[model samples]
Target: MNGERTIYSILHILNGKKSSQTIQDIHIFQLTSLYQSFPMLSREQLEEVIQTLYKEKWLVQSLDNHYFINDTRKGELENLLKDNPLPNYLNGWKFHAITEPFWQRLSLFIQVASHLSGNSIRYIPVQRNPVTQLWLKETLHSIAIDRSNINKYLYKDLVKCLEEIEINPAILINRLTGLKKIGLTSDQAALEMKMDPSLYQLSFLAILHFMIERILSNKEDYSLLCYMIEDNKKNYTLTASTAKTYDLIQKGHNIEEIVHLRNLKQSTIEDHIIEVLLNVPAFPVHSLVSEEKMTRIKDSIEQSSSKSLKVIKQQLPDVSYFEIRVVMARYGDS
Candidate 1:
């Protein structure tokens, strides 16, 4: 229904005619006129399309002022022919028939089509038309950079693009806003626009560029930014390390006294003395200092560390060497 399709259909009907296909032979004037009867193109517009085809080398003009298909140009057009998605009547021109300028025109067509259809334009495949593909890719890359909350990696990628292009921040911001106007997140917009994600991975590199630029702009601000980045990294690492130290404390280490005696933070000495009490159990002071005579003898050197205890009168009960050791550990620390 568009002019491009109209031109293709007219050419198809006139194919293989040795003699020039005049307005009379093919009745093109009547065809254009009849089509124009119902809001068809004006006379001037119809002539302009014919002239454009000639300029593209599609139409050859004979000395007699009659027009025919140029064989070479026809070959180019034939290469672009594809099976129609719809009926032949509705089928139109092949997208690749036109030059890059034409592809640019088609992008505009897509924009208008989307507006008229009242739907957001999501994806536009330009694989077959490399020119349009490149344009769409650039458009997508530009869109993903407006918000700070946009994926961190994606933001970095876009910055890399700006760096490669040598675009100023002000210009970059404007391009980002252009993407926002079309309802796209920077990352989504770039993908939808068919830009290579990896190509933008230079975002990290762009950050370095920004730092360098800032340094040149004003040294003090650059220093502060560097310090802030470092401080945040250190703070996060320290917080995680502190959490691990608390886990050691809860596992029953006498870490506090050890750290205090060494004039260090408890965290710094946890790994060194973790096994200090591995084979020992805690004992109360009262158990070793009992006033009973049997208990007193247990604490004496003759009874202490003795492998076997003497069995005397029934009143002087024997105590195990293990008990003496425990008493010594708990209360005999002289």
Candidate 2:
């Protein structure tokens, strides 16, 4: 943060607030994976947690009311994580929007398939999304699986895909609803597995995202799982505003043109383009900042310890802040 940002910035970052500053922070701080990692976190809950850290003297409040880690206690956070490693499959920025839809489709599909296999097809739906329900109803007739033996096929596909991953199956399995059974909620599953609810939620999301990546990689092999996302390229990768910007960019609009067409501030368009650079591979950010200037920005960032754009802007006097930001998003560490 370089201690230039306020505490609420962290709060907004964790909760995945879609503002330009919040999105820029995700890249500037090298925290892209942790974007939208805690969508369930509340303002009050985060304040309380921050208070605890303050009380423990692990985080100190600056004169400007920004939070910075106490240098002496900074190592403590890393040390604690050493004993309990983070899950390997979390790509929240890439998969956050699709996780819930994917889970809803998969869970509801399995739940319905289970009942059908057992000759009890009138069970309540575990997923209540009307869209997902509609998709399932339409998809049932289309899947190649025999209705009478869907459980066997789904189980086989699920087990085969899960076998390649490292998370305990129960983290996902215990959350499934089948026949006359109701699945455990996140808190319930966490208690049963003796894990913190936060960790359990994160782990659950990680496994789902892992499955998504695997399915996208080999859809022909994972047919049943593949059905869950058969039509799922529904723009979960970009924020709504960014998606609009992406469309305009695809039509060959420059940043100024996008701002004029969308009636948004120039800064807002720049933020969307940064998001494009981060999410859309090979979206041609090189033209936004020429190779020569991008090299200068990258060099400034590499030589400078500060993540402050203001500091870097001082060094590269010719670079626009938008140019510096795009360069940072493209070339920043992590």
Candidate 3:
């Protein structure tokens, strides 16, 4: 039932196009973009869902290599979903998923709980699917056996927060570990609780957020947690233009090729490359800059009072802005 509802949500987004819109056929790329926003399904899973929908006559393919919602079923699904609206957190989750700091903090929370529980568990970064299960298991286990000050505080604080929010603390425990003491999927838990899956997801997120806030507030006392959650020493992010350019580059496009394909100026493409180089640590800096040129740029910046690009550009007048940008990208603060 949850899978069917997920499919309906996808259809709802697809069918949201204006009636007079010419882009009737939803392309695979468009669906992939939509998945980034919702992220409830992977591309492979989405393809499988699409196939199932096609079999059920809920979706149809066009000659243009695109898909569309079946007109007859569209209205009925839309009305049903309207009564049980999609969670407001659907889009917000996308940002949290992409933000490295958020996951780092969550991973620390799990690791701390595991250690305090005497589980000797190694911490791996939390992924979207199993976060709730991991949180509930480790937290409960810590509370049960460990009488450490931190564990006791965490247990008490979480209980107080849940109670204040008017959510049954036991429901989380029961939902995650059903009658057999095995975990249930979010969908199965939703069914057991007689709540909409979307609502359950939102509720879970709220609880998670409250716990996170409580932990973060006492970060000084929870120094290990704070250290673990800190962003990589050099925090950086790609701008929108750079992100597009980086995607093209990943697809094996050269600067000229990217400029041609994107219909952007060569200089603009170069600027985007610089942005990518500056922001992405694993980017092959050596590929773009020679050791000699990098040294020269670094030396020039160190000598200059101002770290401005224009200042550096004046020092290396013969160099193009693109080359100077590469130098700045390597040496400058993000």
Which is the leading candidate under lDDT?
Answer: 2
What lDDT, from 0 to 1, does candidate 1 have? 0.35
In order, candidate lDDTs are 0.35, 0.83, 0.53
Q: Return whichever of 1 and 3 wins on lDDT.
A: 3
Clashing residue pairs in candidate 2 are none
Number of the top-ranking candidate, with TM-score as the measure: 2
lDDT score at residue 43, model 3, on the 0-100 scale: 54
**lDDT, candidate 1, 133-179, per-residue tens:** 56545544554333232234333433443343442343223223222
Ranking by lDDT: 2, 3, 1
lDDT of 3 by residue, 257-297 (tens): 99999998987787677656644768887777777777777
What lDDT does candidate 3 reach at residue 102?
46
Which residue runs does candidate 3 get wrong by more than 4 Å? 1-42, 98-147, 159-334
Per-prediction TM-score: 0.18, 0.90, 0.40
Kindly list the per-residue Cα lDDT of model 2 for residues 117-179, writing each as its tens digit: 999867779888899999999889898778989888899889889997988888999999999
Better structure of 1 and 2 per lDDT: 2
Candidate 2 runs further than 4 Å off: 1-4, 63-65, 230-264
lDDT of 3 at 285: 79
lDDT of 3 at 318: 64
Ranking by TM-score: 2, 3, 1
